[model samples]
Target: MDSLLSVCDIKEDVSYIIDLAIKIKAGEIEDMPLEGKTLAMIFQKSSTRTRVSFDVGMYQLGGRAIFLSSNDLQMGRGEPISDTAKVLSRFVDGIMIRAIEHEDVVELAKYSNVPVISGLTNLEHPCQALADMLTIKEHFGSFKGKKICFVGDGNNVCNSLLLIAPLLGMDMSVACPEGYEPDENILKISKNFAKDNNTEITISSDINIALDNVDIVYTDVWVSMGDEAEKAKRLKDLKPYQVNKELMDIANDDAIFMHCLPAVRGQEVSADVIDGPQSVIYDEAENRLHAQKAILYHYLK
Candidate 1:
């Protein structure tokens, strides 16, 4: 069985998959082939977008999405992830997991007979990145040579962007605090992919330098979910990197603002910017449905 654990897992085929999603969004298709299939969704992390989109996407495709909360499952009460995977594989056509550790997803895939998808992990958010890419394509028409700048915490979202952007020929710049830089191994791997694809990927501590002439300005919260204890400290250190009007001015006139929500209004992005005309946060959020439909179609078939 195949799985979508990272952006790298989809690789160069993302554009094709996203095109299918666009077709779905435009109402060009009626019956999706996975009519009788079942998607078992296991989410350890509480979410709005990921949970809703996958459940809705499966419904749209004529499939059933069974929501399995962490507390509702034996896996939450000390059962091994592999054992859970093995059991779920017997009942579901596919499994989607949103968890804290990336390894848990890997372990599930190891023992499962059915396909396993990574809904969200601490290390990468491949599905969200796919949606973001679809939105970018919708607005810009093409990703080739477009500079996308991401400012703030170099977390999972940033990590996926760094890895996936190169595959589509998009130049990417990430600006973050000194010690909060993206995973070095992931960075190195993406850089190598960038080199081969003729796309430049740069990471810097200087926010202004990264935003210069960038076509897209992306950001996430100073503190992600489950990082509540670090919130105060992160807000202090990351305030300088916030994407407000001042930071947006450094980018090109057409640069669009993007955030993977639940955005902290005054923290990672200003309210005026996120709620303003240029913001594509809602559009990004909506595309989650479309993009996952594409992913489900690809893997299920």
Candidate 2:
């Protein structure tokens, strides 16, 4: 694959990458395949998992990571993404960008000579999707006959899950309020991908119908970065969709709970459920390191 700007970009190799991540996490990857590589991390958005995981993962793979915030890069000073992509490609083996605009991530990958990974974007979180898949595989030992329900705002993390889940042989459902559904084009593409992969996709406003008996019941914060302005409205709209104990009870008995972190306890998910025994948020977060290591190996090594 040239780059991973979206999960769909690496659809055919999704299973391979997940397998590599599993092996890497289990200490099965003996040799450091990325001994001489360097990854430049450009962050227009602040993060905890994306930043630390990529940084540490590179080190463990015998490579290194460079952190570049918006202030550190010329792009913050109005330099075009094309110029930044071209220049950074000459200095680093790969680029990982967490940006406000999905278009910017696409533009960077288009211009860069090296592979560009979408660390996170307003439209999709491809790396996070990889980690989530890795976590699910670890919990259940396989993807067969599994269903995942994304409960809340259909934002970046949910969008990535929509695209990747069905591709990996898992059915996906999203329960969101009206005017808060996933992107139309992405939903269409994911549905098409589902058909070919023999899985299913569904969306609903009724949380009960959507969450019913799913293997994974996942949620993300109602308000996201750059969304502080609409926080009150978002909280009001998504309050009913929160993954509380009652909501969790609607899922399968063995269902695991997940959140792409920086989660608000009483907003998208309750403290009880997120801190409960079934929650795998920490394991999911940890898998970010292994998954991105596999991504690094695939593109840079």
Q: Could you tell me every candidate's TM-score relative to the true structure?
A: 0.98, 0.98
| Candidate 2 local lDDT, 172-243, one digit each (tens) | 999999999999989999999999999999999998889876999999988888889998899899989989
> What does each candidate score in C-alpha RMSD?
0.9, 0.9
Candidate achieving the largest lDDT: 2
Clashes of each: 0, 0
Error of 1 at 151 (Å): 0.4
Model 2 residue pairs with clashes: none
lDDT of 1 by residue, 3-117 (tens): 9999888886877888999998998776867899999999899999999999999998999999999998999999988889999999989999999999999999989999899
Deviating ranges (above 4 Å) for candidate 1 = none
C-alpha local distance difference test of each model: 0.91, 0.93
